[model samples]
Target: MDNLKFENILGWKVPEGSLPCWVISESERLFSIKEKKPFYDYSPCCYFKITQRLDNNFIEGHLGHSEYKGKRFHDDISTSYEYFSNYQKREPVYFSFDRVSLYRLIEIIPNKPLSFILKRVDSPKAIKPNRAFMIMPFKIENLDNFYQSYIKNYLKTEFNIDIYRADDFNDNDIIIETIYNQIEQSEFIIVETSHPNKNVFFEFGYAVAKDKEIITIQNTEIEKNLFFDRAHIRAIFYSFDNIDPFQKQLEHY
Candidate 1:
């Protein structure tokens, strides 16, 4: 483990000099973003044509370009699990999904603006996997139901994750310390900015301070504006419709 805390890499935007990854549709036009990856040279932007938007947030698309080919195995641990076991290595390796969609990663061209796009062609379904983070909006009086339902769905749907609450923690003494410790260690934070609650605001501030990923969702215009001021802080905003879209947004991250 890198002993480094997650805060060490907050707001680290990808350099603008980086190239774009193309997502092409079947008609030979390019549009729609499946995900983004680091840029690499010698790898042209791959293309995929949208075939259908399957129910349950799964999409079906056909691959148009083969410059960067094959579906990615998102789980790096499984790919390396046997190798590490054979070597008797106990150290955990850090994997970056941000690099998965990049092309020519195996080889790099020095200093050129490099880009790679992974296109989806002829895939039966574009799966919208549940994000590791949970988003809870407090205005819904059924806080307990909302929290429980999210946890249950994630567990039932086979999503592996780390969960953290952005509010309801006492700021004095051990409670604050314990909450901070948990947030510090978490991979994601859920902000319930439904009512502009002071506690939720504090929690959001802490998440921003620590540089952790956040998922902010609310139903009203007022709540959206409340979070709008903190655009400097990176987060995915959801206006109901489909929670899966927010999940897709996180997949890109």
Candidate 2:
């Protein structure tokens, strides 16, 4: 088993032998088997050993860490092989591994059924943009301050991107035309669908029709009130007390 040659699996090299093996590395952290790439970002300060490879397309492993937060902690890491296999069958699987404070994507051989890639799925690049046009119920009291202080400021400080609302424009053009023009000029759209506002829905539909990047944010209290037609769409839920997580989510795009 020691003499067996290994191949790249995401950021790790896996041996060809069938027996369970422990991969020990001093500097190497994250590896991609398909791309044969290595990423050092948020590399776990630990070692991993493949424990079992099940016939049901699942692989189990143990993560043994020497030190974490000035203490030792280890746990079992189990994942299904079918997840990566099915994903690779269609397109390359690019994903990240969350390490508490930081994360990174390590691609793996999509054809290898036993391979595991973990983390949040990467967002599509088509909707990523440097500027976002925000559509919300601006008439609502205190909503303007929330946008300016929480949403707009956060985007500017963290992502250095400009976010504009309808009030940002000073042109004397018709309201609908002005909005459409703003949508045309912006790279992406951020829709606040927390409330049942028809204007926001119309703007969202227009943005979708234009094939623009779209991100939806809503207050958690309004989840049950989400329109039936838009219920299936994913949205970032937030509350006044917990807006940081949503801001962090937006930074990814």
Candidate 3:
């Protein structure tokens, strides 16, 4: 339970382009981002691919690569739960991903020059299914009908998960604190991107940089809504009141 507040900085000119994760100031909670370069790494990654933490200061890529080429499990916990195994790299100009892809991960470590053309392969999914957090627009109509009556119950029943929704709380003082706690504790996150909600997207970006399991739900594809929305992430597109198919697509999890 590392309840430490994340570090944030202002006036940072992140290398221009499609960059998402490592470029983020050391921690995922950093709020101010300055766009400097014209590059974004939407490269694809799968299991057994090279990887590393994005915030590593070293200019190399050899810290958290696949070890023993095997998965780890715990005796007390169920193996059904997936984990985002630690994959921090540094050397030869280290880089990282937001790890926000729906079904796959995009791991592209560049050379000292920061050119991400070295290895563009698919990386396996990293997840911890024990806990999940939900983020959505706060001012939506019929809030109870849209969430409590439908989404919440449906998810709890289908996935048998322990979920934490932000709006469920009434303490404004603790909302941000709880949010940080919930996001850190939750193994996966259910983001409602149905609307161009900056709060929701900001939280989504936080989850991406933290390397948490992300499950995004959107009414439609609004490319303009998300500044870091160029990558291919598995999104469940559904109309309000229709959730049958949403359950089906979640099987990919």
lDDT, candidate 1, 93-200, per-residue tens? 111112122111111112122221222222111122332334344556555555555443444454555454535432321244335445554556666566656766
Ten consecutive residues with minimal summed lDDT in candidate 3? 1-10
Give one digit per residue, the lDDT tens place, for model 2 in 83-191.
2344445533332222111112233333223233323322222222577899999767666777888989987997788988887753321345557656765777889
Best by lDDT: 2
Clashes of 1: 7
TM-score of 3: 0.44
Please say which candidate is ahead in TM-score: 2 or 3: 2
Candidate 3's displacement at residue 137, Å, is 0.9
The TM-score obtained by model 2 is 0.46
**lDDT of every model, 2 decimals:** 0.38, 0.53, 0.45
Q: After superposition, how far is residue 89 of candidate 1 from its true place, in Å?
A: 40
What's the CA RMSD for each of the models?
19.4, 19.9, 17.6
Provide the clash count, candidate 2: 9
User: Between 1 and 3, whose TM-score is larger?
Assistant: 3
